[model samples]
Target chain A: MAQDSAEAANQRRTTARRELIETQIHEHAARLFAQRGFAGTSLGDIAESVGITRQALYYYVKSKDEILAKLVADLTSSVVTRTREIRADTTLGHAERLRRIAYLTVMDRARDRTRFQLLDRSASALPPELADAFLEGRRLALAELRGVIEDGITAGEFRPLDARVGALSVLGMCNWVAWWYEPGPDHPAEPIAEQMSDCAVAMLRSEPTGTDPLAALATARASLDQLERQLRIDNRRG
Target chain B: MAQDSAEAANQRRTTARRELIETQIHEHAARLFAQRGFAGTSLGDIAESVGITRQALYYYVKSKDEILAKLVADLTSSVVTRTREIRADTTLGHAERLRRIAYLTVMDRARDRTRFQLLDRSASALPPELADAFLEGRRLALAELRGVIEDGITAGEFRPLDARVGALSVLGMCNWVAWWYEPGPDHPAEPIAEQMSDCAVAMLRSEPTGTDPLAALATARASLDQLERQLRIDNRRG
Candidate 1:
């Protein structure tokens, strides 16, 4: 009976090891895929970069698509969990609570930099259904931000602006942390979060600004709209 | 001789036709690639989506990489040029000038939804050299912002936080327009720019802050020490 119990324990250990390996494969693939893009990279290249054989990689993930799917899935899952956690934390004020959630996003993304890179970099190739699901994770986060802004505005803590756009403006700064927040050179996340909290809160408190951008936009629009209106123009000069 | 001039004119027309086709491919491909992703898409798929045969697609651009390359090149070129022009404008106050520049960035990204998506979705896959060059455009734009913040601090128009970090927070929000700034329901480009400008300026104007996250850092250190001691004792118990 003791021997049988030991055998069962060993089998469990083996299964756990397999799962760890699979997890690493996905992480490695995601890192490579994000850096090089999908078409620009190959399976052998991903395996080689991970210091594993092509066959060993196969033991973990069946193919590149599976790796891509897993990368985005993992990100969406974490975002959903974090979003819910912040939404449910009733003890904190809306501003403080929103700040905490935003900080969590940056910290979480930092720990899983490769996956963030993949989700940001390689997510363009995902099919429509998958893309929508991934984007909805973003939408949920945006909705929570909107809720916090609405709470603050209604409470008179925040100046009244269009809450949806305002929320996006605040959230966008935090989300873009994945793009530029390198751990080595930038000030630590704690202080940076403090700064962001100030900025977001400031955004909440301020009035509207005025600046027009039509001249610059006209350049691109001229080209884009010309195509739209090409056949309708008088092409002949008599 | 008039017919010869007409023939030369015909050559100019043909060249413009080719440029338009190139522009067409860039537009369609950037939109599709940003939505789909590089790996999840195919040359055949892009051609089909463009309403052209694979052969016709080849005549316009050699490969998908060429398409990606063009999008990045085009976007960075325009971004850099506009940023330079904004920086060069001499008559405005540093803060107002910064606001106009920020307005340029927010509006520019808002106009080309595809390039905006590409900034979020495609930059990761760029080869290291190209990616750095592409990013440098943004970095230059940001340098312009940093100058404004530093000048504001010098002129007593802003608070005395780390100017660089403050600038990063501002640019982070501005860069995010691509993901969130849709045109119908909430706020359009002009209003959105104003709201963002308020946040950016307010972030600079607000006095130090109330939460004082530096206090949290010390508390974190104490809690970490406690956890370490508890973990050591638990391991000895086993």
Candidate 2:
């Protein structure tokens, strides 16, 4: 039993070391690909950046294409999974859910701006299977967002508009952050995420027709009371 | 005099021919670059697509970068010029102007979807000077759009919000068309442009509070009139 436990501990340490090297490979590859166009980058450059031989790099990733595919898959799957969770949350109102989804997406893109930009600029250079997988992930995310918007419209929390267009508009607003957001003292992620999510919600809000019906009724009742008092005084004066 | 006229006509024909070939080169280059990424394409490929030898193609463009720079310059200048014109249009209300600008942008992206997509996917591959020029044009366009939103707020036609965020949101909605818009019989451009523009306008509209003041006053007066009649009857009975 003692020998078996020691072997298990040794195995765990080896696994952790491998995982760390793989992560380093991914990071170096992403930086190189973002600096040079994907087509311009090579496995050798990534290996050199990560302080490994080209042969050693292959132990972590099969090819440059594999690195790109893994990076995109990681990015897309996380986003799609979170979006699905947001869509499935029944406790939240549709408007609030939509706002959270928008916030989540903007922050996701902002946090991974470099990877997102690299993907945006190099998607066509990806292998066909990898490209298809990335696109499928995007479609799935869009469907989840569309489902949320449709629910909002059905619940009358959102204005009646094409849910697909609404989804795309919200996605666009969030995704464009990847292109323009630069992390700095003046432009932090949370505030920009908040503002963008608010804008997305604003775009979908149903125009209030003469205010809420209850509020309108209350105002009307108050005016009637005041007018009645004035009329009573006038009648007495007469 | 006859010889001089003939020589002038010959010169004009030569110039026209040169312009035609240059246009063909650009179109073929855009298609190839869009299909294969910028870094993946070559001058020889563009020359072959245009039915010219690489040596002959060099007469028109000094390098592949020049071709890309020209295409981007053409696209950006036209958009910047149109945006500036819309911004300066004093007769139109701010809301209308903003709607028109949004419509124009979406339609512009739709019309040149191929080139726009190419630019999006290959911007980082552009030479530094060309990239700077493109970025400058983009900034100019954003500034013009933001100015319109700011004017709308000042004129009380739009709600007070961050004009920069509003402008980017509208731009994101329109620019994203380049990514997803596929022209077909079922999906027409004009209607999509119209809907997006309306959504942009809706996003900026000041929420109506109990309807317009004139309408609210009219309602109150009508209520007062009815109350006065009812009171008269009550007073007589009493």
Candidate 3:
């Protein structure tokens, strides 16, 4: 009976340890994929990253394709869900909504650049069906963003523009944060997000209905000056 | 004496053929690097693409690093030279210069994506000294671009803004063309360059001064409409 009890406890411990190791595998895979790219990274590389044998990795993941599919799918769904939540928040004005979306996109990228890198740089590694699904999710998010821009134009809150090109340009700017941003305590996501949000606003800024053009340019210039000052302060604090 | 003359002619022919093969090797290597990434591609892969043995490839390129370095350096010099030429053109105004620079950057990328891909995406794979040189070239190009923006603001052609951010953003937009653009005769670089230049203007547009803000927005809107129409026409022609 004592032997039986010990066996049960041992089995439970093994399962828990397996779960922990799998999580580590996922994280290490993400980091490697982000740095080296998906195609360049091998299961051997991932196994070495986790200090495990290839056989052990196989117990958790059948192939790199499986891991990539899961990572990309999860990222797609989360971005879509968060974007929907932002869209549902009707209390915000059109420009504010666009601002928040831009801020949140940058914040998400800064928080987990690995996921963004995988989705942006390695989604092509996924199997066709999985890639299609992930792309659909991304397409939906883009449509939502384009919808907001269209609404803004209708309300004369934004200058006239091609919604598709504008949406893509916004995403391009935000996605690049994943490529360059390195988070620090002093240089937190809030300030970067704020600056990016302002950039989005300026990017979509309409011609002034009543305000002077020079004055409008001056406002943009002042915001840029403020942003640079904030960046300096953050750098000093760091 | 007759035998010696024939030998010399044969030697000249061999040298010419060697140069041609080396150029082919470089082109094939670049295509592979752009498609499969620098790390994922091997000398064997490039050799196969060029229909040669790996041993033959080594006759032209010592390693993949050497090939990438050459491609990147050549591309960097070309871009820097072109940008300087555009800047020195005194006949054009500030906004026109910015527009031409934007168009030329995109046109250059579209003309030979392989070079841009090597410089932008695979410069990390270059040896340290080569990588530093390429980066310095990029820095000079960006500084020239920023200088133009500063001049524009000073001349009151462009609205006041952070020249650094504006320059980076412009580059980001132009660089992305390398990733997505598929070159064709019908969809030439000229129209795309025009649209992108207009987009750059719209992005930096200041508030209305003496001109009606609504009219400015209307003009921006008209340009976008024109761009879309041109795209459709291109698609039909293609």
- Number of the top-ranking candidate, with lDDT as the measure: 2
Q: A111, model 2: CA deviation in Å?
A: 0.7
List the DockQ of the predictions in order.
Answer: 0.19, 0.16, 0.11
User: How accurate locally is residue A100 in candidate 2, as Cα lDDT from 0 to 100?
Assistant: 98
Each candidate: what lDDT? 0.69, 0.82, 0.75
The stretch of ten residues in a row with the least summed lDDT in candidate 3 chain B is: B218-227
Worst 10 residues of 3 chain A by lDDT: A207-216
Q: What is the two-chain DockQ of model 2? A: 0.16
* Candidate 1 structure quality by residue, lDDT tens digits, A37-114: 677778899889878899888877787777777777777866777776776777876667667766676666556766
Candidate closest to the true structure, highest TM-score: 2
CAPRI level of candidate 3: incorrect
Name the 10 consecutive residues with the lowest summed lDDT in model 2 chain A.
A207-216
DockQ comparison, 2 vs 3, better candidate: 2
| Native contacts present in each candidate (fraction) | 0.45, 0.30, 0.11
Model 3 CA lDDT for position B70: 77
Give the true-structure RMSD of model 2: 12.9
Task: Supply the global lDDT for candidate 2.
Answer: 0.82
- In terms of DockQ, which candidate is strongest? 1
Candidate 3 structure quality by residue, lDDT tens digits, B1-238? 9999999999999999998998888888888877777789999999999999999888888988788777877778777888888888989987778888888887877877776766675567767888888889988998999888888888877778777667766776677677656888655666656656766765665544436665545544443454354445444554
User: Judged by lDDT against the true structure, how good is candidate 1?
Assistant: 0.69
